[model samples]
Target: MTRFRAAPVLRALVTLAVLGSVAACGTGTDAVVQGGTFDFVTPGGKTEIFYDPPSERGTIGNISGPDLMVDGKTTSLSDFAGQPVVVNLWGQWCGPCRGEADDLETVYENTKDLGVAFLGINVKDPQQDKAQDFVTDNNVSYPSVYDPAMRTLTALGGKFPTSVIPSTLVLDREHRVAAVFLKALLAEDLQPVVERVAREQ
Candidate 1:
């Protein structure tokens, strides 16, 4: 009897077909397509945008924000109020994280001068040493909470989505969700978004 080897090939085709269907939506959350809008891949990994630039585009949620521990100090979002804040979730082994590290640092350096707060959530990192080294090597000046179990992430409730490895959440000066980028980010991709929020009253 000839062995049935079509199953694997069929499964591969189906996977590709599903990805194509999502891409065909043309919403541009898929980094490959570039920004038509901000993408917050939620519960089912479906794309959603909670906010946009220049003005609030969607409903604002009641988020008390989370208090994450960094370097033995208790820190909360409230501590960064009165200015735009950027929260980035990343890990050591994530390839995209490495690629975007410099971009994040560059933007942070420039925007910090403008009083923007950048916080990093190091999630699911198996190797804390490697994670710290990554920050040191990349010259990441932002303070990051070590979240091997993602406690800080989960504690945020639905305020922040930690499902995306290199996700970024941009908050306006009012501390409301301004934009959520569910992909690896670049300095150029974030500068305008941050500046827009900073300019808001």
Candidate 2:
């Protein structure tokens, strides 16, 4: 996703407004809202993990869209049911996305045998070929949902960050969140997190 280019004052005011609203409602401390979509904001360099049991965790609904690399083909979150999934929201134009691509693939390779799955969500790239090229150049084996308008993010429920590029979510076997990383990451940073979720019974 594109960086927030608003002036510092404007950005601060907007953030304050959102925080005030969330606080007023006694909602989650991590909750953030923009363009009518709810998401968990990862203040820079921070990660969020959910330790709630499966019975208490919020589940992500199925999100479907065209395949980024294959025309006329589609992919969905439901396809990976009963497995731990690493869901990444990225854009071909984002530098962090490019930087993390190889690491993501590495983690995917290492953990797939453990019943771990990986899915990418390509967002805001109007030129689909650029997104396709990104996957090809990075040798990404997993499928990504091409969502130029980021519409698929709604399925992640109110706790998912729709506008954060390079953000990641680790879901448990039942598709409920186990961890969230809103910053760019390397294999060393992502592998253990996926493994932890994969170990969940």
Candidate 3:
């Protein structure tokens, strides 16, 4: 397994973003309501997330997306059809996503020899360049599809839901989802699942 580290530039950018968000809060001079809690409303009411952590299972139809970049080539989900694949949904701005990157990369490295293909789906974010840089910096050697418009996510019935970062779906050789990991993955935590899927092929 490879040990992954975040680039200094990415760390700085994340720190700045956090600071900016914190600085935007109201100051002492601002008018404060008495004894009333602030209520936050989502644009479309409460989002129904498709992923359930307890079940650890989800089935999605054949989902596809446009090529982003991987190993310097453009590719799509359809290319891996007929092969068992581990699809990871992630974003550069997400802390959990960063934590799971190395685990995913390790899975890719270990399972490729066993005929398992790893695919990445990048979610929409304000910083596309930084997202690409994150992939490059980590030396991720798997294909990643761009989801700037979240087309693939929408196709998977994930729109209007506050989808968390670092969700992963495992598809069997026939392209049917076998399992869904709804949280950040660690290399040790994923080994059994990887082995099971790889052996199924």
Candidate 4:
């Protein structure tokens, strides 16, 4: 598989953000990126819940990479097969990511008993130590795939926005996308949606 570098995409998005042309979180304006089978609903940093039935929902399939916290080891979405997963995309340098890290851990601990798993995809930060330190500092217990190149975003088949840091995706038991959050979020905002998705199937 060809690894896709994230610098170009992130740089472009950063420029847009600086220009005020890109809407940050809480803006609430809906922007849909239609590509292939998945309809990526990026609502100005808000969440987009897929109400379609499980079979009709889109899946990103299996994505794997080196384990950020464990050297010589790898992690993959398929590791949590048959279970619901909360996939978070974050970079250590991102302020929003740092702010939301604790909240993500909170939700993970709260729902792990229900067979809900949380996975973080460490992106953009090429330095492994920085990303690992962020996880350590935040007391994040969940496993993260170290993908500095953001190659896993390519696994989404061009449907997901690689530029969106602090993004979250809640997957159902079938590994289909159930909800998508394009910005930083707290446990209060994430917990309920997770519980609801966990209840399905």
Candidate 5:
């Protein structure tokens, strides 16, 4: 089996973030990458994991649903409880998001009614109109919560620290996170995990 390598999308996001941090903090490479050690061994040694949040807090996938708005309406992760929810974090300016938009939409089209839900958290995007336009251009019919303020994102970080853009979290039927992909993806990268989670009792 192929271990999931850090794809170009993940590398790009990390590079952009490092550049921004370097500009903002005037720090060297080591300074920007902070925090202490974290040890997590993926199940079966597969890098792109099938995981559950380890505790009630201080880790990824341990939080409950966040309330947000899309197209002037309100919704939350909890609303889709008892169903697998594909939560994708993206932004309009992100090249990888644009590259992966169709893949997300394709999987969404295929599995929407099979007790699966797809939600987009459009964060760090300054213009809501342009973000909506991207969805339209991609023929992505799924509703995405516009999060210019990143309120939902801030909440996510407080609960689960993997707040990288162009990331995806596959929440199992019980609303627990089943898997997380910290990179842009093809439909193939997504469908297997989604199908597996959907099969959960």
Candidate 6:
């Protein structure tokens, strides 16, 4: 299996420049090389690229069953509806998720006031309590929804299936998927998406 990795800064810079030119030309719904290939509406009102990640795309809907506990209370994805929500599926055992934990916490702090809610769905972790402890130890303020059986994970079509950590889905106010990130996210990388959703209302 070939693992997909994010490009380095220099390569991404070149790709972004090319993508910008393509966007400026007013091409509709065309693929452009930008950092990574992505399907997006360019500033010129054209679809710049079509993002097709075998690991990221999946169906969207309400995830329910056994309640997920945050500080020992039942929780569901619906609780965060009527607002844009960022759902991060992760586990303590995943190294990449740990690498991105601090960044995610920062994202929660920065976007919480914008009416964007952040939640975690703990998946397939043998040490559930330890996973919870990781949250506490990291001082992650966002509430997490636990999925011991990986019902939610399977529902997401096993995107980022290996670690099953660091996979994040961003839902708009209507609970539609706006974006999905398969790797750890930096604050800058996530800012525009949150800002766009925040402006929806």
- Give the least accurate 10-residue stretch of model 5, judged by summed lDDT: 28-37
Residue-level error in angstroms, candidate 6, position 23: 55
Worst 10 residues of 1 by lDDT: 28-37
Give a tens-digit lDDT track for model 6, residues 1-201. Answer: 123343566678899999999877643321111122223222233221122332443335565433334443556567776888887888888788888888888887888888988878877765667877888888888777666556555444323343435777777766556676766777777767776866665
| lDDT ranking of the models | 4, 2, 1, 5, 3, 6
Worst 10 residues of 3 by lDDT: 29-38
Candidate 3 Cα errors over 4 Å, as ranges: 1-59, 70-74, 158-162
Write candidate 5's Cα lDDT for 5-40 as tens digits.
Answer: 657668889999999987875322110111212233
Winning model by TM-score: 4
Q: For candidate 4, lDDT tens digit of each residue in 1-201?
A: 223667778888899887784455423221111233445654565455554677778877577777888876768788898899999999999999999988999999999999999988888887989998898889999998888778777655565778879889898888788888888999999999899889986
Over 26-100, each residue of candidate 3 has an lDDT whose tens digit, in order, gives 231121112211122233432222222323434444445445553334455567767788878888888989888
Candidate 2 lDDT tens digits, 1-201 = 145555776889999999999777653211121232223544454565554565666566676777787776767777897899998999989999999999999999999999999988888998989899899898999999888877767766655656678888888888777777878999998899899878877
Error of 5 at 174 (Å): 0.8
The global Cα lDDT (0 to 1) of model 5 is 0.66
Clash count, candidate 6:
2
What's the CA RMSD for each of the models? 14.1, 13.5, 18.6, 13.6, 16.1, 19.4
**TM-score for candidate 5:** 0.66
* Local distance difference test scores for all models: 0.67, 0.78, 0.64, 0.80, 0.66, 0.63
* Residues 52-146 of candidate 1: C-alpha lDDT, one tens digit per residue: 55463432222222223334354455567687888788998899999999999888888887789997877787677888888888888877766
Runs with alpha carbons beyond 4 Å of true place in candidate 2: 1-45
TM-score of each: 0.66, 0.75, 0.65, 0.77, 0.66, 0.64
Q: lDDT at 102 for candidate 1?
A: 95
Off by over 4 Å in 1: 1-71, 155-161
